[model samples]
Target: MDLLRYVAFTDDPSGGNPAGVVLDAEHLDEPTMQATAAEVGFSETAFVVPRGGGRLDVRYFSPLAEVPFCGHATIATAVAHAHRHGVGELLLNTLAGEIAVSTSASPDGTVGATLVSVPPRTEPLADGDLAELLAALRWSAADLDPELPPRVAYAGAWHPVVAAATRARLAELDYDYDALATLMQRHGWTTVDLVHRESPTLFHARNPFPPGGVVEDPATGAAAAALGGYLRELGLAPAVLTVHQGYDLGRPSTITVTIPQAPGTGIAVTGTAVPYES
Candidate 1:
């Protein structure tokens, strides 16, 4: 299989989360795709099979397993496709659902992609689930932001949205890997979206993806989209939000989220990605 490496969410190749893109994965089997993703050693790798008509069949894989949907990989794949097919609208059929993406080249020569997720949903976090999550995160109920209550949010994949009262609390992220992984697997959660609100429009985020066999994900697009749904469902956020992630890990990624006025509408996430030197 031919593979291309790119970093999503940042214009600099060294920044953002790195992903492996297989543009021609039509013949690769599930095990081959999984093993290739493991060999790539990135948070996730995207495999694309062209179905023509500006549509593609997309799949995402982490080092350990396959996920229903992945935000960064989607962005990476869209931009990579744009590079070959010319920037425009593209449709992706994923396990989660169909997603629409648009790609373009900025005036400064940076390539960017915007993806609209499937209709989002938010659910109240079960009391027992909250307790277990806090325990695994080494946090207590007091550490939480009262204004933004806990919830399970989904835009393509499921994530537990927990808000921290202070940036200090959000920064110190030492968690029990095994415990969190077990809980995440049982609950079918892709990541835990730990966030700290800096303002009405700006927030800081960290995602622990133990189930993916990664200690942490520098930038998580799916989590960001889920967060948009969570905020909208709770009526806690404005229509536009900016998420800053991977700062602590030194990758520093920026994700722009736009929530429409319509209920249950798809969230749009925008970011730039850069290809790595071969």
Candidate 2:
């Protein structure tokens, strides 16, 4: 029942998103896991139960509830396992689906993990839902990017992909927390992926995660994967892309996404993780 803390997407411990990792939680039940996650007080915590033969059963829990999948926690868990065991591939069974993760150590001895999300898909955002969501965020249709249309995307979890027309719009994030949470709950969305495309291969993002009882997520892997899927589906992705997030919060994070040419395949998200002191 050792609770390990690690920050994902940054080598600096204080820069990325912090996640609680229980490497071995074979005996803990759902209630205990939920309580432990709440006690950790991070955006999300990962509970890993070894199923033997390089396979692990993983569960993700936010402070308030259990989520189907979590990208940052998954990255943290993989890095933690690599530190304790060794760098290699792991098969993770999550509520969303099976995810494949590979861990490696760089020349500088930095541990990095790349996770291949389950096959991703996208659905159109209904006009009514879009109006309500914009109202919640205090944003109008004019604020949205004309190129990247609004859509509900899913990799391991669901996220509404909203692209801001300008970087300034993305930077100024003052949203109705309660209203956004209610809208997200109604749509079963894990987070609202607010993004602004800087270049063809570069982007900046912010994630509002009120459904998880958090105002915002510093780095969101699942949402990034979903965004990749949405881009690939629309023929807007250029093989690989970099997403910079958490800068507004002073905890900068970098996420790299690899898009496959094949249709209906998993998206790969890679990032580094380190032991967190705070």
Candidate 3:
């Protein structure tokens, strides 16, 4: 099987989050997919099988296990398909649900993909859960942004959305990885969305993805979608928003989200992908 590597959310290969894409995995079993993901060593790898009628069945596997959905991997797969089949709209059936993705070629010869996530939802974080999460991160209640509050949000996957009051608080990411991993495992959380608001339409984020065997994700499309949902549900939605991520680790990525007026609708996450030599 040929594994195609791509970095999503940036035009430069050295900038975005890298993901492995298997364009065709019709004959591959679950074990093979899991093993391949581990070997690839990216946070997640997408296995795609053509289902005809411009539809593809996609499965995402992390280094440690399978995940319901992955934004960066989906972006990579869509861009790869566009390269082979031409830029257009495609329907993807993921473990989470159906996602619609559209790809286009830019004037600069770059391919970009925008994925509409499954209908997202959010639930208030229980006090006990919040306490545990805070303890794991070594953060006190004072560190949180009261404006954003805290909640568990879901688009394709679950993420605890925590907003830091200051950029400095968000940047100091020392945390108990194992403890947080265990907590996330129990709650079925894919990542901890640690964010700081730079402006009404601009945000900076860091994602702790111990569940995927990655200490941190350079750019997280799934979490970005969840954040959009969280904002809309809380009546803080913006017409358009930009998420800036990966600067701390040097692989900067940019994700743009567009939220519709209708409630419980899919959140659109757009990003560019570049081929990686790996």
Candidate 4:
């Protein structure tokens, strides 16, 4: 099996989240896939088994366990497929649901991919859960932004949307790993989507991914989609919004989230990717 490495959400190899891609994993079993992902040691690794007719069965595995879906790995896989097979549309069968991905190239020859998530939904964060979450993150209730209330959002995976009132609060991310992991595991949360709205059309984000056995994720596609859904559902989203993430991690990445006017629809996330030698 050929293991490919690529960074999603940025054209530069050193500026985005790295993912492992196995484009042809037709014979690998679950144990092998899990071991491979663990060995790869990125946030997630994508294993694809072609089903023909532009359809593929895709599985995402992190170092510790398998996940329903992964945004950055999906982008990396799509871009890798485009480089090898050609840019077009693909129907991905994931554990979460069927995801539609499209690949295109820019004038400067950068390959980009856009994945439309499954219909997103949100649930109010229970008061008890909120207290536990804040305690784990070492954040106080007063640090939260009133405009963007806390919610558990789901696009393909579940994420708790926690909005910081100020950028400074968002930057200070020293959370208790074990406590947060336990809380997230109990709630079945994929990540804690910590965000700060810079403007109507721009935002800053940081994701705590203890569930994935990682301290944080630089550019989280799944959480971004969930956040878009949360904003749209709350009537706070613009038609187009830009998310700046990974700045504090020093691997700055950009994610573009597009919210359709119609309610109860999928959200679109677009970003460029590049192959990296690993």
lDDT of 1 by residue, 1-278 (tens): 78999999999877898899999999999999999999999999999999999999999999999999999999999988888888999999999999999999999978999999999999989999999999999999999999999999999999999999999999999999999999999999999999999999999999999999999999999999999988888887688999999999989899999998688999999999989643
For model 4, the local distance difference test gives 0.95
Question: Please, what is the whole-model Cα lDDT of each candidate in the order they appear?
Answer: 0.94, 0.96, 0.95, 0.95
Query: Which pairs clash inside model 3?
Result: none
- Highest lDDT model number: 2
Model 4 alpha-carbon miss at residue 195, Å: 0.2
Report residue 69 deviation for candidate 4 (angstroms).
0.6
Q: Candidate 3 regions off by >4 Å?
A: none
| Model 3 lDDT per residue over 49-81, tens place | 999988999999999999999999999999999
- What does candidate 1 score in Cα RMSD to the true structure? 1.0
- Predictions: Cα RMSD each: 1.0, 0.6, 0.8, 0.8
lDDT digits (tens) for residues 154-223 of candidate 2: 9999999999999999999999999999999988999999999999999999999998889999999999
TM-score of each: 0.98, 0.99, 0.99, 0.99
Task: Provide the lDDT at 1 for model 3.
Answer: 92
The better candidate by lDDT, 1 or 3, is 3
TM-score of 1: 0.98
